[model samples]
Target: MKEKATLIVVGTPTKILDSYEKQHAPFTKYKFHLSKVYKGDGEEGTEIELLQDGNKDASYNVHPLMEVGEKYILFLERSSTGALIMVGGPAAKYKYNKEEKVFESIDGGRIDEHLERK
Candidate 1:
């Protein structure tokens, strides 16, 4: 999945910027402060905006949204409008387990083997 992404980075969500419908689908824009760049050209501390599928309300969302201040490793690609989006929706986003010092898939899938290769 990382191979198909234009940008892959570890970052913390700073804020939820907006929630709007795009092409009839609800989407939310998030502001993330980069903490590490695993692949692609992003600098640590750089703030990047990510357009994720779903709205602010979790009840209507198919995928879970990023929680503010939580660290995440994201696999992203540029959309048609040049906005960064998760390459595989919920599958490509991983949340960091601070105590365990490892990342766990947001959707509850096991991806440690894949991450170990990095």
Candidate 2:
């Protein structure tokens, strides 16, 4: 999964910026504030827009969506339109557990164990 990702970062989802249809599928744009850059070109404290594959109203959208203010470790790739997207859908998103100081899989996908720590 890491091999396929163009960008890998730890960040918090700040807001849902927009929702729109692309190529007949629903897409959502999110405002993400970067806290760390494990792999890729992003700088800490930078805010980047991430595109997800579904909107809030899409019934068939099975990918786990990022909640506002929740911290996450994201594995992303660039879309053809030059937007960043999760590399493996829900599998690429891991929510940070502040109390436990660990990363929990949002959809049962296992990421590198080493990445679970700061």
Candidate 3:
């Protein structure tokens, strides 16, 4: 079985974000690698840079990518019934170049699609 967090987001729900947080009060932030982003479409959306530690929001690039800090990431919460509810969709995944501080996506591999198909 997969590990359970306080909340989780499956498929992708644009409207369900606020409700999920309201349900998980004192909302905490959970950061993931940001494998992908879906613009409510089946095709893979733009990829955001990944940071070892960063916020998922804040808008740095011209593209709608989440910032890397701590507060912007999504948090997962578990319900009283012991089911995991999705808190939020996280930032897109970018490669972490040790030498370079900037976060950027790799040449042509997408992670979100891989996860979805799985």
Candidate 4:
């Protein structure tokens, strides 16, 4: 079964939990795709709604890493490892809107994926 992400938050660039040392996370954003929201797993992110292009690549232009509405809000800051860290409040959260038959990202994620992309 396919699922969709619920919450996509853009928090200050922080270190993603990795082995060895605690360095800043690579991605410019801290996207929270809740399993509960997508009915998926911890490994693969929640299944995103496919674009009209028929592409199934996990990576998409609508990467929540990109700031929404404004540009400065999601700008990236270089980390020690050259990884881009996010700044500002991209902190988004969401719930499954069963009534609408789609995931609703409170912050950013679930939406008109079939029609929109960054």
Better of 2 and 4 by lDDT: 2
- Per-residue CA lDDT of candidate 3, range 1-118, in tens? 0133332222222121211133323222323333233222222332221122222333224223333331122234445554332332233333333354333332332233223310
Better of 2 and 3 by lDDT: 2
User: Among all windows of ten consecutive residues in candidate 4, which has the lowest summed lDDT?
Assistant: 47-56
lDDT of 2 by residue, 6-83 (tens): 889988999999988867898889999999888889999999999887888762445766789998889999988898
TM-score of each candidate? 0.86, 0.86, 0.21, 0.21
lDDT of 1 by residue, 1-118 (tens): 9689888888899999998886788888999999888788888989999988888653234468788999888899999899999997887888887776778885565444236732
The model with the greatest lDDT is 2
Clashing pairs in 1: none
Question: How high is the CA lDDT of each candidate model?
Answer: 0.81, 0.82, 0.29, 0.28
- Residue 49, candidate 2: alpha-carbon lDDT: 96
Q: Specify the poorest-scoring 10-residue window by lDDT in model 1.
A: 109-118
Please list the residue runs of candidate 3 whose C-alpha ends up more than 4 Å from where it truly belongs after superposition. Answer: 1-10, 16-24, 27-78, 81-83, 86-110, 116-118
Backbone collision count in every prediction? 0, 0, 14, 8
Quote the lDDT for 48 in model 3. Answer: 23
